[model samples]
Target: MNISENELKMMVLKACRGIGLPVAQAQEVAAAMAASPWALKQLLTQLAKPILTASFDFSIGLDIKNAHILRDFWACADAAYLASPRVCIRGVSSCDVTEALARYRGVSVVAQGEDLLVMVDERPMLKPARCEVAPDEWQQLETYAALTYVPETDASRLVGAGAGLTDND
Candidate 1:
């Protein structure tokens, strides 16, 4: 399926949020996915992994030994963007997604062994107007995004869900 960059971002944002990522982190992941739509598979993989708590230190950067890629990568990117010229993240399972995110954040990433070195050097790229996505991947993303929706119910309708009580107004 072919979708505009904005559409992809919104879908990814909803998917990330559906998986329980905080709004800010979800937005970051969405922007990264939009920047590199080809990384959708990696995004899905990362989403399926167990979410783990990350440890960060100004002096030590981010250590993701037991952490999931979705949240910790962005956190490390933010840290690199703000404080250090370069930050090292260990045990990154989704290098492609991490690289995409680093590009989105205008940072450079170099993988060394099982670790990633992110530096605040690169400039963010402009997103393409349209990108091709595998139909299966798009469907999977839709499935995840669907978790954000509220199921239709009579009570919800009365409260003004969808078209609410009337659409003629």
Candidate 2:
């Protein structure tokens, strides 16, 4: 429960890699944390409310048969996008779950084939959100699954540009 400041920074760095954050961007965030860990932590704590939620349509076919794996994979992709509001892609196939699920989230697919693509929002640091749903939610929806995405409540700690910044920025 009580992670040392150094540990927290390392955890953030690891998470950045997990979500495929560009090296430079990841370093920038890590540096900011190293400079002012308390500032970032307070910012995160403040933004911890009024969670964002999204539902998706997963009617597309999948080669993977394990529902749990499939669910976790989809959740990771969705969380990546929600966390960054950018095109977070996974899988190699042109038409894999990554593309199908992204479309369900109402985000535009900038490119596809070999790997799914989405335009990076480059907006100021959005917190990664937790995706949750009841056990029978997927079954009840019949190919459609509703996930509640609650972003990190703190806004001040968030790094990155706000919607005002363009990808070029």
Cα misplacement distance, residue 105 of candidate 2 (Å): 34
In model 2, pairs of residues that clash are: 47-153, 47-154, 48-153, 48-154, 123-161, 124-161, 124-162
Candidate 1 global TM-score: 0.85
In candidate 2, what are the lDDT values of residues 142-161, reduced to their tens digit? 22111221345456435532
* Model 1 ranges off by over 4 Å: 61-64, 83-86, 162-169
Q: For every model shown, what is its TM-score relative to the native structure?
A: 0.85, 0.23
CA lDDT of every candidate: 0.78, 0.36
Each prediction's RMSD to truth: 2.5, 19.9
Positional deviation of residue 13's Cα in model 2 after best superposition, in angstroms? 0.8
Off by over 4 Å in 2: 39-169
